[model samples]
Target: MEFGIFMPNSRNGYIMAEAAPQYDPTHKHLSDIVKAGEDNGFSFALTMSSFRGHGGSTQFWEGSLESMTTMAALAKDTTFMKLIGSVQLLLVHPALAARGAMTLQDISEGRFGLNLVPGGWHPGELESLGVWPGYDYNEYRWEYATEYAQVLTELWRDGVTNFQGKHFQYDDLQLGPLPEGGRVPIVAAGASDDAIKFCAQYADYNFRLAWGGIDALNDIMTKFNAAMEDAKRVVKPYVALGVILADSDREAEEKLQRYVDTADLEAIEYMYTGAVTDTAKGGTSEILASMDQKGAMQMSTDFLVGSPSSIAEQLDEWADLDVAGYMLVLDDYVPDIKRMGAEVFPKMKNFDQTKASVA
Candidate 1:
């Protein structure tokens, strides 16, 4: 199975706790982490786009680097390993996003992908830019995203697009300098039925939060695969994981407790409230439920916290489910990157280092 880092595009990575390693969201830090992943045999890396962050002591995700721009710069530096950047569909036009993705593809020599996010959750953020679309828009956010993806695919593949949809319109426009790969891989989270169908139909990969352990993941994958089969398409399944590792299981547990003890309740409350209030009707309710249970700790449903050997064993359980890959989030980047590269990855099965290189 493939392995990838959910690159820390925001401060404190995804831990959302005061005890988590604090780091600035800077290009240098990102470069270091990506370089470590490159040296370690990670297949790909993806950056999430967050316009604003939860308010609290740690300022969790309050500051973030622009996803596309950062990936564009990283493309010039990395020789192997695909780079996936996120596009908040509501924030940018499809034509603009398509061109930026093509530019990234060229820079990476075809090793580029796009992660599409239907961004209607943060009405405050959208309102700041005067594109909020109002609260009721949530009901049709997925529909808008469907058309958004259609426009992007047309522009990327045809080089010239002329189409009109309920949410977007494009005249006879010619966009040149096609990507090196001719087509860029698309990824989207399969949170709701609409999202699952959309990903099955258009995206090459579907990302989901790996909560509820292996059983939950298996159930989700079963449903997603059925949907893809119905759509007559094959899309790989990818899940996000939050990991905490140490020399021993005891040490790992201690670290996890520290994070839990120092959990930013204020931020967690803000996130949960916003999720319930701002999210649209068709979005994944499971995610909100999980967040409620976990209190916004950013731990995946199947969180991994153990020694290298135990972590490896747990990963084996996941691999047994036939998952395509994982997008990993960590409490700390610098040390954890090295640990994952040096310890856990070597013990995991099917992740042959020799074949991990993207190029």
Candidate 2:
């Protein structure tokens, strides 16, 4: 399986204030994290895009860098790691987004990719753009995104697209200096049924939160595969988020709990309420409840927190479930990234071959 690092642009207060005393918005700090990942054999780094943050004690989003621009910055700075910008399609014109992607692809020498996020903040954010429409916004948003990507893909392939749809229309548009091989990989994330259908139809990768162990992943894979066949497309493997495997299972649990305990309750509360305003499923309690029942939040491994050997065993289990890659979360980016690269990756790369030889 491929390993990717999730570069945290913002952190909950409890985690930020407690875990690392030196949390700065300086270029040096961020560069260290990126350098660690690149040096460590991590293939990609994922960053989320958010336009505005709801303010107050419970900060909705405290500090987030713009996605595409950040990716461009990282691309120029880093050498080996593939940089992903999760673009909120509703907030961007496809033509502009495609241009940005092509530029980043050139900057990164074909190591740039995108993730499609159709749902976003509600009236507040939309009104900020003066583009707020009436109800049925969700339906319109998804349809617009689908058409937007359709046009973007066409243009990226160096084709003059005269695409017209109720939500989006492009007249004889061609994007030049196109992306490598006339394509850029796209991933999509959501738990809603509409989101799943969108991934099945358009994405080269389906990003999902790990749930209920391998069985749960298997079920999700089954659904995605079925959808792909129905849509006359080949389904790619699921790339999971929130996987923080360490040396051992016990260590993993301890680290997760530490964050939970240290995390600013007020900040988390704010995030929960903000979700409601964002038209997202609300509350940390509710989210955790769902995760508990479904075994979603924890790493789907008895080995992740333990030593490298233990984590490798758990990874093999996940590989059997068809997980293509991981977007790993960590308490401290630099330390964990170095550890993952220095200790874990070498073991994992050869683990399967050793097991095969044994069998």
Predicted structure with the largest lDDT when compared to the true one: 1
Instruction: Write model 1 residue lDDT over 320-353, tens digit each, in one string.
Output: 8867888788777768878888998889875678
lDDT of 2: 0.62
TM-score of 2: 0.80
Clash number for each model: 1, 9
Clashing pairs in 1: 211-301
Q: Which ten-residue region of model 2 has the weakest summed lDDT?
A: 293-302
lDDT of 2 by residue, 140-187 (tens): 566777887898888888656899888777778878887889988887
Flag regions of model 1 displaced more than 4 Å.
278-286, 289-295, 299-301
Clashes of 1: 1
Candidate 1: what lDDT? 0.80
TM-score of each: 0.95, 0.80
